[model samples]
Target: MYFAKRNSEEPEIVIENTVVYACESASCNGWMRKDFASENYVCPMCGSQLIEEVRELPKIQTDFNSFK
Candidate 1:
């Protein structure tokens, strides 16, 4: 009997020691890695200013230095 390939059940991956920035506007859901965020800390999608925040999100690997 031939068996078809089955999807592997893997747990979600988590990242550590990350800094992020989130929109300060009350009606926005914008957020990004501080290092990769806009130069002015503005939310590109909502045009709102950003603030430093701690969050758990999918890790994004980038070569750009986030520090100013």
Candidate 2:
């Protein structure tokens, strides 16, 4: 896991958190980080349509420790 570092020495600054597309279907628990989402998004778990969702999550940065 390696996030593109915009600045090597500067701290990560996420002014706005990412918007993920999650399955709105009650039977599914699938979502994709918008950055990695495809053109036509669908639930990875149940193949249902997706909808915009804002989760109370901290900004995620790709790093070796995160993969671990």
Cα RMSD, model 2? 10.8
TM-scores vs. true structure, each candidate: 0.61, 0.58
Off by over 4 Å in 2: 1-16, 63-68
lDDT of 1 by residue, 3-66 (tens): 9988798867766667788889999888887676658877888888889978766666555644
Candidate 2 lands at a TM-score of 0.58
Q: Cα RMSDs of all predictions?
A: 4.2, 10.8
- Name the lDDT of candidate 1: 0.77
Please report the TM-score between candidate 1 and the true structure: 0.61
Backbone clash tally (model 1): 1
> Model 2 over residues 45-67: C-alpha lDDT tens digits?
88899999876555666774366
